[model samples]
Target: MADYQETLDLSSYAALGDSFTEGLNDPGPDGQFAGWADRLAGMLAARRPDSDFRYANLAVRGRLLDQIVAEQVPQVRRIAPDLVTLCAGGNDILRPGSDPDDIAARFEAAVVELREHVDTLLICTGFDTRGVPVFGMLRGKIATYNAHLRAIADRNGCRVADLWSLRAVHDRRAWSEDRLHLSPEGHQRVALLAARALGLAVDDPEAPWPYQPTPSPADLRRENIQWAREFLLPWVGRRLRGESSGDHIEAKRPDLLPL
Candidate 1:
């Protein structure tokens, strides 16, 4: 349990990605400071009290995969970080103008460039956006990106974190007003993931996770049914009993009642 300053230097790490990685909906530092990377840094600073691990967050709002390649990758190279954590691809999915296949390809290229300088790489698979109309294809596109990323990580022997599964559990409360951004609690959960993936212990285990209503199978199922009832069914499928748009099933969900 060395102090964070003792365990690592300020220049030891770097964070790269888009808005989710940047904490857009979060209250602190506005969009620039609200992301998972900041939460993770706070946790590490506390846990590794001796380590002065420095993390440079290069994520931007509304950045596409290509934008990351042209911007973030070069910064990573200059920093030459020991550990790199990246969460991207959501904007690519939501950008009506961009092709999914191309988005996946650009993500892969960015990862390749990142692997060159960073010793340990952590890439997020993105979230499960089953209910959002704008992100209808997000799940599939993320899967495609993860599959390719898996191959790349396997070849290079880097680490990959499945953020899709982590966030797959549905909770309207987990999302911010934007529906695209994660709430405060969501960022905390993400911090926990980053700590675990990097082999770092949480600063305060007894302290509640920064996020709430932890992602679990039961939660995911509940979210799915609610999602279907509110958006999917209302949009295209046969309308379910008492179902309506902009309204999530919130009471006594038979499917998740046991949990």
Candidate 2:
């Protein structure tokens, strides 16, 4: 790894990706999503109170790598932000018959294009799912994608926040009941990791790890049943019908605004 400059004058920040970046499941008081990108923006704002720190999030749920490249990437190029974070491909990898190599190739192309326009680029690896129940089946695919992501970042001179290596995120509590998105605490930890990856001065980067309680067999069975009924079934139904959760949804914070 190369040494990144510890200081940044981030006047403008833009985030591009899917639900993970859109802050899905991390609802705000006003019923809007407030995910890790938003949290990181807030922290950056606090760091430079005197400067005008602008941020935009152009992430929608259920977006694939192709959609992100086609739709979100152009907007970020137009914004030409001081810092940009791109986290796509997760949704694509989860789908049936998806190839990790193809995903990585598309992702690297996007990174190559984005890095040419932005001074600072940040990309993240997908989280490990070894701890998740049925989702653990995708662990190998996720690892392949993560490996490619690191290589892409290195070639593009982009920084990486290695979510796959973050042990805390493996904790079941770090995830929401849907098992797709992260909880508020999970987002917070990710935000801190992003800040640190950008070489920003962040407090409590080594925060205490979340405690994991062993669930009884009955509890596990009940939880699995609930997850299948509430989340998995709907997800499968949507896939069968070729529908998407983000079909009509627009970006939450589309325009750049002071933080």
Query: Lowest lDDT 10-mer window, candidate 2?
Result: 203-212
- Which ranges of candidate 1 are over 4 A from the true structure? 1-11, 29-32, 167-169, 203-259
User: What is the C-alpha RMSD, rounded to one decimal, of candidate 1?
Assistant: 11.8
Instruction: Give the TM-score comparing model 2 with the true structure, all chains together.
Output: 0.95
Off by over 4 Å in 2: 1-5, 204-206, 209-213
What is candidate 2's lDDT per residue for 162-235, written digit by digit as tens?
A: 99888778777678989889999899889988988998767554466746689999999999999999999999
How do all models score by TM-score? 0.68, 0.95
Candidate 2 total steric clashes: 0
Once model 1 is optimally superposed onto the true structure by TM-score, how far is the C-alpha of residue 258 displaced, in angstroms? 47
